[model samples]
Target: MEFEMIIMNLLNYSGEARSYSMEAIQFAKDGEVEKAKKSIEEAEQKISLAHKFQTSLIHSEAQGEKLSISLLLIHAEDHLMNAITIKDMATEFVDLYVRMSKISNGGC
Candidate 1:
């Protein structure tokens, strides 16, 4: 795959993962545990795909291939990082919400 295409894929997947994380948080807030979990799962898959692309770039660079660092690539990296952070936070939030719900319902 072309470098630009790889960057674009990273951006697209990262953005999608971030969006799914946001959706998961909202669902958790709304007390939709199943939906929230599903969204988190989707986000994880996207993040995994993005990671694969990132690893490919890293491997190429390690093989002495000169990969030009572009502003777009930096932006994609930022998006990927943010997506990972948000996904992790969303998982915590989901767990918190579930715990709160169980506590409120007297289920311990």
Candidate 2:
């Protein structure tokens, strides 16, 4: 498989994960806890796919062959970092919904 393809795939996976995470927060805000949880699960799965690709790169580097970097790889890394950050924040937001649900009795 070409490195460019790998990188593009990584970016797609990362973006998908980030989108799902955001959706989870939206669902929670809309008072859909179950849907929120499902979103999180989907996000987790997406992240796992990204992680697998990341591990592949790391493993290749650790084995003493540096993977040649390209603009696509950089773009993918950017997406992966942003996605992870957004996902973390989304998780916190979702947790807050749990507390809010307690106070509002899931009315909102």
Candidate 3:
């Protein structure tokens, strides 16, 4: 596969993951635990797809093959990192929302 194709896939997956993570946090803020869980699941799926692309490159490199680096490749990696950071932060924010909900319901 071409490097451009890989980078496009990475960007797509990262965008999907980031959107879902944001939705998950919004759901939590709205006091919808089930919906938040579903959104988080969707986010995880996207992240998994991104990981697949990353692993393919790593596997090829491990076989002494070269993966060309380009501007798009670097941008895709940047997007992936941002998505991952957002995902982690979203999880924490969701947890905090749950705690707040519990407290409001008098059982925190």
Candidate 4:
């Protein structure tokens, strides 16, 4: 794939991951446990796709390939980072919600 296309894919996957993470949180808030779990799974898949593209770039650089550093590339990296952060936080939030539900229901 072309460099630009790779970067675009990174952006797309990251954005999708972020969106799914948000959906997970929303589902959890609505007490849809299964849907929340599914959303988190989807988010993870998207993050994995983004990480695959990122690994290719890292390997290329390790092999002495110097890629041009463009503003779009920087933006893409920022998006990926934010998506990862959101996914992490969303997982925590989902867990918290589940715990709260169990507590309210008097479950150990």
Q: Whose lDDT is greatest here?
A: 1
lDDT of 2 by residue, 1-108 (tens): 566777877998999999999999999999898898898888888988998888888888899987888778888999998888888888899889888888777555
Which of 1 and 3 is ahead in lDDT? 1
**How do the residues 5-90 of candidate 4 rate in per-residue lDDT, one tens digit apiece?**
99999999999999999999999999998899999999999999999999899999999999999999999999999999999999
lDDT of 3 by residue, 1-108 (tens): 776787899999999999999999999999998898888888889999998998788898899998788888889999899999999998998999999989989995
TM-score winner, 2 or 4: 4
TM-score, model 4 to reference: 0.96
- Candidate 1, residues 2-104, lDDT tens digits: the string is 9999999999999999999999999999999999999999999999999999999999999999999999999999999999999999999999999999999
Counting only residues 3 or more apart in sequence or on different chains, how many pairs clash (N, Cα, C under 3 Å) in candidate 1?
0
Model 3: weakest 10-residue lDDT segment is: 1-10
Cα error of candidate 3 at position 34, Å: 0.9
lDDT (Cα atoms) of all candidates against the true structure: 0.99, 0.87, 0.90, 0.95
Q: Which residue pairs collide in model 3, if any?
A: none
- Ranking the candidates on TM-score from highest down gives 1, 4, 3, 2
Q: Where does model 4 exceed 4 Å of error?
A: none
Residue 100 displacement (Å), model 1: 0.8
**TM-score of each candidate structure, all chains considered together:** 0.97, 0.89, 0.94, 0.96
> lDDT at 27 for candidate 1?
99
Q: Could you tell me how far off, in angstroms, the CA of residue 81 lies in candidate 2 after the best superposition?
A: 1.4
